[model samples]
Target: MYPTHSLLEKIKLYSIILWPILVTQISYHAMNVIDTMMSGRAGTTDLAGVAVGSSLWAPILTGFNGILMAVTPIIGHLLGKGEKQEISRSVLQALYLSVVLAVVVYVAGVLFLPSILSLMQLEAEVAYIAKHYLIGLSIGLVPLFASNVLRFFFDAQGYTRITMVILLITLPISAFLNYLLIFGSFGFPRLGGIGAGYATGLTYWIIFGLSLLMTKRIPSIRAYRLFSHWIRPSLSAWKAQLALGLPMGLSIFFEASIFSFVTLLVSRMFTTDIIAAHQAALNFSSLLFMIPLSMSMALTIVVAYEMGAGRVKDAKQYSWMGIALSMLIITIASVFLYFLREPVAYLYTDHPDVVALAMSFFLFAIFYQLSDAAQATLQGVLRGYKDATVPFVIALISYWGIGIPSGYWLATQTNLGPFGFWIGIIIGLTSAAIGFWIRLYYINRRFSSLRS
Candidate 1:
């Protein structure tokens, strides 16, 4: 049986493990909220422009983020095993690979933005604004990918606080930049929605620079990269990274694309007001999700380290501890969101219809957080074990087979509308959580028995 601790001890441990993650997640989303608010002030068209453009932009960026996610577990295992040289080499390779990937995606977005926007069937004004925003946002892809590579490297080293600090500074800077650029303040010309894009692009470079500076200070990282041996990429090492990364990357793409597809479907059925409201609720939920996300990340490092150290039992304990903490944090956040629903909605928009629609979606958001926390934590645990492919399959089935169909049925066939759509999300999340947890349990048991 797992060991139990005092409630106070549990809370303290959870705080130590989770607070940095919570802060990073909140700060990241706070930047988005600030962007939405600033652009909303520009005009309704500006708000819709950002929303639609982001729908396309975020998935592509997140796909690259998936590649970096593959780096963390490998680095964590290397760190756990005291293979410092290997860790350094992995970091360098990840950075090089990420830059290449970013270039490919950025060029694709820039070259295809006009055509992509046209395919979305958006109004001419909305499409024009979205295309302009994409052009500017595309410039930051390399920096964003660089930042993520650094984040995974540091996280594997158990220095998550570094990311929290970087985000704290970056967010305020981004917000300030947005204010000046979007409004033509500080003698800056008002570029409107495109200005918001520029602020976001600049912030990515700032984050990348700060992360690189911090990495340079670490003796291990410095030694590994400065040595001539580290400059060459191992074909085997690259293959290993790709083997571990591609499935996980595809899994992320699958999940994100499902949401993107749903957003498009909803746009087909509703007005811009409804789409904006859906975006607000989705953004808020995604922010809240960072709490669990951060914990899951922490758990992945802890579990991977423990496993690498040949402490299988300890690894299992860490997984349970992380999951318990994630669920509790999400539950508390859900209650807060429930009571403050109206105020939360107001933060995004003042339109009565949008506000009402956002509130309705919040109802589903509250419930979904529990399942999301569970699944994400388990997924993190799985990453620690190098069990990526199975989880990918489970996610595909849950999101596509169950979640999407249920959502369409309820939203269009029934009278639930946007609320119906979120109901599908809730179902998908629950299925994923249960399936992932079961998989983790069995895998751990088998590994433990094999070791014995």
Candidate 2:
């Protein structure tokens, strides 16, 4: 199907693509994990603030990031069709979209955020810290979105290694800044939970600015003429992107909203220690999650290229390859998490109560990680096919219709408490994973080629 390449050859191709993605995910996610750890050190209240704030921020971040995803698949499809020149317009349009979304998100976040937090009924001090944290974070949304736009442009051409290098290089600096600011290290004013927020915004803006400069200075990037001309976004492009991306945005929103809700409610229903534990356990789970997420993105690019080139069977091969690879890797990672949860939890915080609580909750992550891996891979495959709408609805139903409500019910009504919330997570992810795979199956059967 793919010019008779050996299984080893396929693995080689995938490996070339997958390694950078894996490394990048680690670095990218490390920023948040670092924040949680440092905030934990600052105090339990600070840690709870960061946790609750991140929950709200995750949905905003993930949803906007998903919407801006129009650029990557577009670039991949163009590359496959040998239409490299048109990529500049797509880049320009995506930038426009990114900036506009950034402004809207910032405004909406600032205006309605207080009311939302008020409803959560968090303690006065924690709420104050979270409110300020969102403010600092809101300022950086523009550059953050822009940086991701640049990432999509380069990553489409298999130049993912640069972004990976950038993030890895940024990771340590991010940690250093968090330490300096969170605790007033080196004579700096201690900002507590809000310090991580300020550090994050500044670091992200710096990354975005430097990345843009690199695109101009780097010969490889200059070849695309991405900055050669300014082009206004056309109606058709807007329609096309929104049609493809809105569902993606909503889908991501629904899934993240569940966790966000749980984090907020837990803060109200339990002590700051439980919130800290939730934050720490979540950070650990997210660290491992990057592996499957990276694999999924890489597969999306490969599958899009193959499908666009009319290599339908090759696309399918890569699809299965992606799924199998993720499952195997996650299975091993789960085993490691199973045995090492205590040490890992200890790594986040010295507080015995928080450590124990986080470790207990981590067992649920081990069980659900498999489902999460499958769902992530499927989401990517569907994106490659540009068939996001159906999966979007499925995710909404799975996560919201079933996941959040049930988790809330369990948390409120049952003795399982925090563990009950986790049980809901497992059910949601498992259902979404199965639903996504089934959607892909229908698409494959209905259309001979992936690009329908």
- How many residue pairs collide in each prediction? 0, 0
- lDDT string, candidate 1, 223-243, tens digits: 656334547666776678888
The Cα error of candidate 1 at residue 263, in Å, is 1.8
> How high is each candidate's TM-score?
0.93, 0.96
Predicted structure 1: lDDT: 0.79
* Candidate 2 lDDT, 417-441, residue by residue in tens: 9878888888998999999999989
lDDT of 2: 0.85
Pick the lDDT winner: 2
Q: What is the lDDT of residue 191 in candidate 1?
A: 77
Residue 280 in candidate 1 has what lDDT?
80
Estimate every model's Cα lDDT from 0 to 1: 0.79, 0.85
Worst 10 residues of 2 by lDDT: 1-10
Model 2 clash tally?
0
Model 1, residue pairs in steric clash? none
Show model 2 residue runs off by greater than 4 Å: 1-4, 449-452
